[model samples]
Target: MPATSTNTCRNNAVTKVLELEGLTKSYGAVQALRGVSLHANEGEVLAICGDNGAGKSTLIKVISGAHAQTSGTLRLNGREVRWSSPHDALVHGVATIYQDLALAPQLSVWQNVFVGAEIRKTLFPGFSILDKKRMRAGAAEYLARLNQNIDDVERPVADFSGGQRQAIAIARALLWNASIVIMDEPTAALGVKETAKVLALIRHLKDTGVTVLLISHNMDDVVQVADRVVILKAGRVAAQGALEGISPATLAQTVMTGEWPQVQ
Candidate 1:
């Protein structure tokens, strides 16, 4: 497949939802990130790909506020900001869905969706209780918006398939009104059908105006859904631009060798 140029992938007028400039992270004497920089445009799917030990995890940790960068600036919606913690980032409309999916197996789908942030009702001036009905309704609405049909939102997540669990996780993010959603290898361990569903859901997210930063080793998934690709090599950005005009083989080669292939 011919790759599309960056200019042709998306309109240049789209707002940049997240921006990182000269970002670096270090642990004692060992540096994990070396001045890596990139930007995710609004309503675009940006795939981050690299070989093992390429600092992909570290970069996302910094973006999610799990770790602070040693240097460099992070801009959200064009404004510089520092996050004190992951919750701080979430509060600012940034949400991360790790490979684990983070759904509680013992809890119902709606319960998992609003675990830490449940709705509440105050019957009196000083009394409040969990609003189970409202939470269930909200969860159902979000799931439906994602075109996910669950026979019962009250059912435990352990009974659901891998793809369904991922949908619930994404629904939770949407319920929080997240504008930027970061997914770490969402299709990992999923069967072909399940992976296809998740890929379609990711495309749905972009269509709904959500910016996605996807970190994955699956070139096929990235090529299928990503509007742009960022290749990281040993904690530094090797190559990045519009995915247009780039082939999966060329992308894999860039990940392994940290150099763009010379066109013949």
Candidate 2:
């Protein structure tokens, strides 16, 4: 059965925030993804793990509106719709934080947080001014809420560490009221302490009732922060289940060999 056919592994009581059924994507002669399906519950951390060529990036692109699926159905909050672009997905409350982060290096923290979606106040008809004061304050509040160590919101993001930059990106997503946050390789290239901080931030998002879709190769991080996991092999789901019942070794084995072993 397809992964989306049944929400058996999911908590039936909670509503599914995002659902993809038989999602397939192809690039000319190259078929990047097959008939992949999955669902993410509201306020839960769902991890997607796979080997190097398992089409993980293609799947993420499909869901984030970076690429349209060749054949499949994507349902958001039980409604069927197609997003034209990443901005459309963001408008629908689906925010993706890619590895590059897309932050303007020279811009201040507050500026980066509210880059395209700037807050504004209208003083006259057809005229509005950017609410710099409110944006700065809001940015500071969001960062503080996440318990990040960035003391100054007016400083350029280029001056911050990798983990601090990740925290800011997350804050921007939450500031936009994103119901579902998709993070791709959030811990990549970071030191041990930095990775821990990002993991804690993910936990914080879950605690605040935000659904998170985490894509990472770090089995230890997945085991530590993910509530559930879906392993992909050759562009299809190989195994999926709650992390509490599966060990990190089992997850690693499933990714490497495309087999789900008995947990005992």
Candidate 3:
């Protein structure tokens, strides 16, 4: 998904890489989203925390261009954009990793990394084939940059551990020069160690200057990586602010009740 929406951070430090204003989506008479807004800043991690049916998936779908907005502005770097398709969002450097991660179990790591956008070496005047050598080398370079220790880029994705597979998916996004990465329930079913590894990768992305919008119900992961928390309740923003400004207890309260505390 492309980083299509931006909301101002209550904290006063950075500029938003993406913004959404009055974003709405509907399915016939049923409204999935209504006038919701949020933002992800450059190099910052923004977490969207909400329970099931809180409109999180709809929000990501709209932003990713999997679903068109019924009304509102999708802004990247403050300019309103009307994304017509998911590829349009991808062309704008927004890459989304759904819970599925979109990896091919039967394909080699390098092949999956360059699946649609494979590099070609024109050996003759008009012929081109997949450049296995270039692809392998480039895949190794990217994996190494992520500090991953995969010994064989030729091996299938199913051979890699969960963490390594997640790393490969992330590296694929980076290979495409994605500036904003949206990850939905990235750590959903992983064991403790795998979840830790994915969390570390999230931190690594933040340190490497990529803005991240993480969607998860895990409060622990939310506080650990997110600089700010945007709680989407009943298709609207119920509470949003710097993480430091809100406590875990308060966040949990908001999740259960859909109301921000007074903090008096």
Candidate 4:
């Protein structure tokens, strides 16, 4: 079993966007997660940090509906939800941006952004056709709102920069009116400038009232973007608290050592 924290400050902000209570998952004799619990509030970015085999990926998969919890309660906006699959979670406005970005390299920018959920219209009352104009216009509108300027919405996303491609993926989630956005290693394999752009876009999402769950092994990235941090070890929460309540040194130590050594 992983550790738990009972020391919570009174003045902490309220407004829970996502919560996991007693979440557990097992495979044969090995337990992937043992009663792991965590939460992220609206307009806040929660960073889930842990080393390899820490069950970080497992937890996110459960919450994002990729995997079901063997035993636990999953709640969104104070209501318990039973998500059978990733699509089920998406129906509830939960969007996930995986490590690969999931963009079709061969597809055009607008096509990729509006791939699964494209806009269509009816022409001549009965015979309906896809609304290419509205989609192009809407995609352009969304990208522009994010301070991103892509010359051609019809251009293939493979031709865009890493930062621009990430922005497009995020814009797609926003277009769906997603309430909870989960990003896995968002800044991985990017240049310094590209990383900065991704961070700026994440802040933009928070400012727009989107709850963010950021999974990263990079402490500097977590400290820079996460409002709260949840450290997991051996499939259970080792420590969970506001970023302001803990120092980076303490956080690093807790993750690497898996022991909550009292701060000196």
Best by lDDT: 1
Screening candidate 4 with a backbone cut-off below 3 angstroms (N, C-alpha, C), the clashing residue pairs are none
Query: What TM-score should be assigned to candidate 1?
Result: 0.93
lDDT of 2 by residue, 19-38 (tens): 99998888998888889999
Query: Which sections of candidate 3 miss by over 4 Å?
Result: 1-13, 245-247, 262-264
Candidate 1 structure quality by residue, lDDT tens digits, 1-264: 110111122454879889999999999988989999899999999999998888999999999998999999999999998999988887777889989977789999999888768889999999999999988987887888889988699999999999999999988887677888899999998999999999999998888788999999998888889999899988899988777777887888878887776767
How many times do residue backbones clash in model 3?
Answer: 10
Candidate no. 4 TM-score: 0.91
Stretch of 10 with least lDDT, candidate 1: 1-10
lDDT of 1: 0.87
Clashing pairs in 2: none
Q: Look at candidate 1 and tell me the lDDT of residue 188.
A: 91
lDDT against the true structure, each candidate: 0.87, 0.86, 0.84, 0.83
lDDT ranking, best first: 1, 2, 3, 4
Per-residue error (Å), model 4, residue 92: 0.9
Better candidate by TM-score, 1 or 4: 1
Model 3 C-alpha lDDT per residue in residues 111-217, reported as the tens digit of each score: 98887778899999999888999889888877887789888999999998888888999888887677788999999878999999999999888877788899999
